[model samples]
Target: MVFQFDDLKKKTILLFISAPLVGAGIGFSFMFFAIKNQPTLGETPWRTYLNIGASDESMLQKAIRTRVGIYALPKEEVIYFMASTDSDGELLTSDQRYEVSGIAPATKIWSITLYDKDFFLSDNALNRHHFNASSLNVEQGKPFSFVVSSTPEVGNWLPAPQKGNFALCYRFYLPPASAFPINESSLPKIKKL
Candidate 1:
């Protein structure tokens, strides 16, 4: 035995069921788009989220910043640039070898850290994932370089995951105002070799 509802009751039921579903779909898409095309400020391969950790940041920007595990510092104090590709715009993967060379600007400190696709340190035997001002072969005001590979390298080996993709984050502490829109060439050059 089946009983059908009147038009008004049926409309109410439909709204109840569809409202949440529609809202959920809209919300998920909004977040996904925001996170995927996340507003950043830079050229290809290396970009920094706009207003990340800034007082005037939108909620979405703050959320993206937190998701990426960046330490909150006003842009005036610190800035970060992330790259997931080589110089020729190739997606950086674990299987390839790369030579990363750069000269740090006159900041309090700087570092280059490697992260897996999940935005965490790549797992490797050396337990090494980054090289910073204090941990490089070159001195301040000089060019520094390193290698990113799954296999051990001669010097400055920032490990890569054995079987997945990865990214690199360059952080500058107490960077000067002129450092805005950090120059692409100024940042480490990741060349597939």
Candidate 2:
């Protein structure tokens, strides 16, 4: 059977009108699931919220560069706060997780954790992997770099979800910022590598 031009036009209009209703139905379904299921960090991933650009390359390098008063925080003081950072376009596989490593000369304590899109600690078996500054076996002489990956070789690592995006949040307390440039250099730097 063949449809005439006028019949086709009517069909097209009907499809257009029905399309929005279909989409609304799907949207409502998602909202219901979101309310009922309540996704977790690894369960839904968090990389979707990140935005990176090469235009800011120089600016980022500048942020990483050493500057005056960069490490001015008091070493004897304990500052408690959770700071979040993002990775470029580096996608993590299901087998991968997160690992953060850094050195503190005189800091009494420090930790890095992963959170879901909702800004809550990831709901995982390990209860959100976190390693204190003293608990880490970081190298000496220079600031340490931690690898937040799904499948890290060894050292401090945070397990991620099976297949979804995620984020990192670092908390420093009584950090040796005066001696180290963590404040100036930004402890966690996102990478696509």
Model 1 ranges off by over 4 Å: 1-7, 38-44
- The weakest ten consecutive residues by lDDT in model 1 span 36-45
lDDT of 1 by residue, 88-177 (tens): 778899899999987867774888889998888877787788889888856666888889988888878888998788999988888877
Error of 1 at 180 (Å): 2.7
Residue 149, model 2, lDDT: 60
Q: Which 10-residue window of candidate 2 scores lowest in summed lDDT?
A: 43-52
RMSD of each: 3.2, 13.5
Local distance difference test scores for all models: 0.78, 0.46
Candidate 2 yields a Cα-based lDDT of 0.46
Q: Which residue pairs collide, candidate 1?
A: none
